[model samples]
Target chain A: MSTPSKTLGDYVLGLADDALVSAQRMGWWISRAPQLEEDLALANIGLDQLGQARTLLSYAGQLEGDGRTEDDLAYLRDEREFRNVWLVERAQSDFGVTMARLLLFAAWQSELYAALASCPDPTLAGVAGKAVKEVAYHLDHAARWVVRLGDGTEESHQRMQAALDAEWPYLDELFRPVEGAVVDPASLHPLVLARIEPVVAEATLEVPQVAPARGGGRAGLHTEELGYLLAEMQHLHRSHPGATW
Target chain B: MRDWPLWEVFVRSRRGLSHVHVGSLHAPDAEMALRNARDVYTRRQEGVSLWVVPAAEIVASDPGERDAFFDPADDKVYRHPTFYNVPEGVEHL
Candidate 1:
């Protein structure tokens, strides 16, 4: 059994992992987006995610008292070591799919950060305060795209609905409490769901109905896709352990 | 759909100031134009407001008109307030 401190470290790492994985996914679209404006927007959102990851990972390292920096956690972790939900690691299917993912992810993250802003831990609260603003903007951006695509032309509406249907299954894992996981599900559960429901409804997307995916990320049970994601994300760091610009 | 036209962005950093040209971006319409302007131009929190006009709307004076248009103003000291005088009680003067 893990001590409370260690459990806290694990919980922080889980949040950091979520940000890190999402940032990597967004970074992949840097120059490959359909338009220049979207390219910049994705890049900006990726930077925000990376910034949040850095803060959360650093806090986790400090809590662990393992002398691991943010870079150590981000660059040294292997696939099985990461704790991000499967939603963030899935491949970017199409523009509408990407928007759907963002809409769902950002809504949850915005609420999570808002609650964390008042967490008992001062460091966590500080980090969450800064991150909440960034996530709010991210949520707005995604929501706008969802509304536009969902209500636009027939083709756009069809594509966006398809994307929503496809991505909905993955959202359950976001709110699922890992059995014996560090963070208490009962403590955070109500706040997370309350904040996410309205945004999901506003987007005209249905709440995920599937049973939560078993094997929570806190247990290091990740989807197979995480391996490839880690391979690409950790390559430079693993290749040159202490590399710096 | 094809991409939107480029729009030149002007921002007013504060009230009572002229809108200064910042940069340009492509937007599908006026609504999108304002949003893109807010994101790209005001991310740094530099502006209190923004104005986006299509790049094509701007007209320019010929470079050859520099002397004829601007040089005459350089010699017109009367156009400026240097000759103004005020009473001792005129606080602003």
Candidate 2:
């Protein structure tokens, strides 16, 4: 492949990191979701995110023209060195919160990937084309959960609303535009909102007017939770350098 | 969560193919059950379409009636496709 501009590389890197971090978080739900079926569902969704991470990471590495492999990009980086939004990094111990974060994140990804699917960059376009379908499923799954919990019993409705409120702050981070990206992130915000609003409405949930969190993940700045997550994710690689089955 | 009803899943591998019973999963409603079936049964390109029916709705015949219901047909060799003569130039019969 001819040399890709660093701008494109950085944009794809952000996308890769987004999928990678979200995969790590989603993996936490396996065997831990409310039901066994839900566990399998989350595991499948997590695997999808992991698959996207691998493909995008490899492409991002190529664009950077650096010798770093996907493994190097994942295992060797410090928390601040990563570029995923805080939406996927923070602790989501509550299942409702997990679904809420997923709904927001996947909605943005749905729009972002759809826009990127037809971009001039063939590699990015190819990746986005595949990812758009995967994210569509993710969005649907999340929306289902959000609707079920939010419109169910009073206790569940309260909890789901609270989850949405908690996740709202991180929503802004997703729309911060990155240079050299196929689509302007800012441009996809309204489309993402349109995808999310109907789901929220049907769930009988409100989109809270909470202030946006201070987000610098695109600049390699991350939340305190990311450090803990990175410790777990990077530990195995650091302990057994270059070892693989 | 315990209130979620169990749904029997059926998957059609492709168009023009009959849906085969796969397995069962618990879901709150038919829409969610279809999504759950997509995740549980069709994750590996296993099917193009899915059907989810509430487990309570299926009226399965009693196993105790196995002899009365199926044994009578066993001795009727004429009813079996196995008695058909082998035709040349044909396969997968």
Candidate 3:
């Protein structure tokens, strides 16, 4: 399929939405993870994602030239306006599911940001350079958890496998190409899959053989789950509009 | 699931410094314990290195022995280097 022609603002907003939505989902694990240590680890990961989102959103606002601040873009947009992939927007409560999603998403992000670090856009390249370092650690953290659960016990292995199966369908959406971006999403697919394959093998798990889900998140289409997610995410700011922290 | 074992964390902020105890956490194994300690204690770039020891393996002095174990050196002036006077221009001594 041919890539869509998008402005720099559109591209930046898509990247920002991915990190922002993923951070929201990750924040849900702060106090509910299996272990206390895991709670802190997930929270820290969420913080990293939040930081990346802030930078990307700020840059997007500048590119749009509409005087929309990052907060305005983040808190004022409706679900249909968001451009995050379905893999990040789906509601994930299972720990194994969370790890599986993170493993794939972070692997893709690691490759994406690494490539974006050298993009023609100076501001975008600068943001991606910093994000590349952070996402590398996120990828490592997710890879370790996937292995730990996938190889630990029979029950854990089963759950991990199931999680991977559930998340597999969303993988295709991440590789959908975008025109005018430094990184071609199509090119990143093999590199990211290669990174995940060894980790999956070490965990004694099979790469999922599911069909891909239909996705158009980059075109502002999203699953129903995003509406609820945005409602809760934007509730505080909407409740007290024009309020500053 | 059963809880993981407790681990005492120690961090060395820079080169030539000894690892000092910062805090503790729980993990399923040593590798995880080390990673957990890195996330929990070093998020602020507070350390250059980390050490995670199983809490059960740490042998700490008894709190009840505080006065008996530490009071003897309090008034031992004769054993102190301060009792000896330096002649002149001693930089580090």
DockQ of model 1, rounded to 2 decimals = 0.42
Candidate 3 similarity to native, TM-score: 0.94
Candidate 3, A24-60: lDDT as tens digits: 9999998899887889899999999999999989888
Report the Cα interface RMSD of each model, rounded to 1 decimal.
Answer: 2.0, 0.8, 1.4
Tell me how candidate 1 scores on lDDT. 0.81
Summarize candidate 3's per-residue lDDT along B1-93 as a digit string, tens digits.
466788899999999999999999988899989989988999999899999999999898999999999999899888877877788988887
lDDT of each: 0.81, 0.90, 0.90
Q: Write the per-residue lDDT of candidate 1 for residues A147-219, one digit (tens) a residue.
A: 7777777888778888877777777777666542434545655675675566566656566566544545666
Better of 1 and 2 by DockQ: 2
- The lowest-lDDT stretch of 10 consecutive residues in candidate 1 chain A is A178-187
lDDT of 1 by residue, B1-93 (tens): 455888899999989999999999998777778877877887777799899998888898989998888897887889887887766787855
> Which ten contiguous residues of candidate 3 chain A have the minimum total lDDT?
A1-10
**Candidate 2 residue lDDT tens string, A97-149:** 99999999999989988998998888888888999999999999999899989
Candidate 1 interface CA RMSD, Å: 2.0
- Candidate 3 Cα misplacement greater than 4 A, ranges: A1-6, B64-68
Go through the candidates in order and give each one's DockQ.
0.42, 0.85, 0.77
